[model samples]
Target: MSQPSQALQIRTSDGIVFDVCLEVAQQMGLTHSWLQSERGDLKCSDGPDDDANVMPLNRVRSDIFKLVLDWCQAVQTVDTPLEHKEMLQHQRSLFQRILTESNATDSTIFELIIAADYLNIDGLLQAGTQHVADVINGCDSVEAIRERFHIMYEGEIDE
Candidate 1:
């Protein structure tokens, strides 16, 4: 049996806490990766399983984060030629891994945007950005965007 890492913890502002394995915490969207992009061991702010933004951490079930990390890493490295069928296959494999490994409607494809950007995966970043663009472009007006993403535009039009 593998000894679990001591680094994983879930902490919340409400004083809830839970100790979790690194993998479980990561699957919970409580990965250090999700907390912030600080080049350190992935962590929750408070401690293992403290449930800051996440209540009853078991509710958010998705290992898409792991796949996102793998995809970002694969895209950043030049081990495979981008245009090759093999490369597409690799990407597809990563996608499928996310599908199979993750449960819930969350795909983590959106999360890839941040990971790709943070890792400097230009092609992947462009892909993610473009996908977001396509989604936004489908909307005919600002109201549509606001409704879809729950954003309040705070812009001043200077004349």
Candidate 2:
């Protein structure tokens, strides 16, 4: 069953405001509910004043957010694809690089992958998942991936 939607006001880093549905806002990273929005608009974790370059992060560091948005724009427009703006193999190579360097790189790529998944960006998701799968299917065992990603294992008994 779908959760009941609520009203919410959100401000992006650019100072632009949006009257977002509560459910969509909940999709964001934070423990919040309708109660918080009762009095007035709530300042979110990704508020424009948020310091992405500093401690408190803004939705996928500012520069990375712009990069992801650029990728989205290029991928979404049919004209852009047909215009041969970027080759498919080139895009795959980029995703592959992001997937592999997930540890060394900033969290922006993962955030972008999550956003793409939520938005039903299948191409990006597949590419990202493949990159992740490659990591898992590499010399590292299943236990390695779990350890790297911090997943609690409950299925296996102690050896």
Candidate 3:
């Protein structure tokens, strides 16, 4: 009989630890690559007691990490391959749902974009950026866009 794969312990910047399944961890390109490069056995942690063996994601905040984990879980795939168009549409829909379900603010979406970039999650990055672009496109003017994203119109300050 085959042995069950152990969960990977991920410690975020805010000191929160999550016991993530190996499959979900694989969806995170950076984490998978890190694991492959290390080639060392990672101690599976059941709780947040020990930090020695936990993979540290210092750039990702706890709330964003939780959202990213939720996205990863939602998009976990089997061996089936999807075409580019279908995949893009599916990713867009999934991202929209994730944002709506989490009641994500514009600031939160922007944060997710940054986190996706850092994590090397291409799909999430693409979808997030696209969503931002779509929102911008929907706006009637620059001020509307700026207001929607809470961008202050900071004029040039005196040197």
Candidate 4:
């Protein structure tokens, strides 16, 4: 007999709930060291308790969680069937659009960084960090960085 599909329930800080495949959920959990026990069981050693089957991510916003989930899904599916090159390209285009749409502001990027770090999603963390670096790299001076990131400098500027 075919086995029933296994799923993992995720509950975000904003009370948003969603379901993902058990494999993907395990992947997400594996990124955080504390989530695994000595025997490699999915145990929350220093983290929040699991609510039945729902893993509560109380520090992550729902929208940001959604983006992180999308990133995870994209990374997981990057090696689809070789015959579906066109579909793969289309998926990549969608991923790029989503990244661009989310990267519209410094605050958004900051939120993404926070979410990625909290969720222990390494790919998103790297992407968010690189985006911040790219923004900083494009600036010519401290003033430009401040302006680009909308930072308020209360101290006197060095000549």
- Give all TM-scores, in the order shown: 0.38, 0.42, 0.87, 0.71
Collision pairs in model 3: none
lDDT of 2 by residue, 1-159 (tens): 997555454434444444445544444433143334443444444764553212222343444434444455444444444333355565677666544554434245566676556544556666666666666787367678777666667775466
Worst 10 residues of 2 by lDDT: 51-60
- lDDT: the better of candidates 2 and 3: 3
Q: What would the C-alpha RMSD of candidate 4 be, to one decimal place? A: 6.4
Q: What residue runs in model 4 are displaced by over 4 Å at the alpha carbon?
A: 1-4, 30-50, 80-96, 156-159
Residues 17-104, candidate 3, lDDT per residue (tens digit)? 8888888988899889878876466764455566666788999999999899988988885257889998999899999999999999
Pick the TM-score winner.
3
Best by lDDT: 3
| Model 4 per-residue lDDT tens digits across residues 1-159 | 999666656788999878776666655754334335323443333434555456677888788777877777766775755455665455445545667866645666688778877767665666677667776999999999988777877675555
lDDT (C-alpha) at residue 19 in model 2? 49
Residue 111 error, candidate 4, Å? 1.4
Ordering by TM-score = 3, 4, 2, 1
Candidate 1 — which residues are off by over 4 angstroms? 1-65, 70-110, 154-159
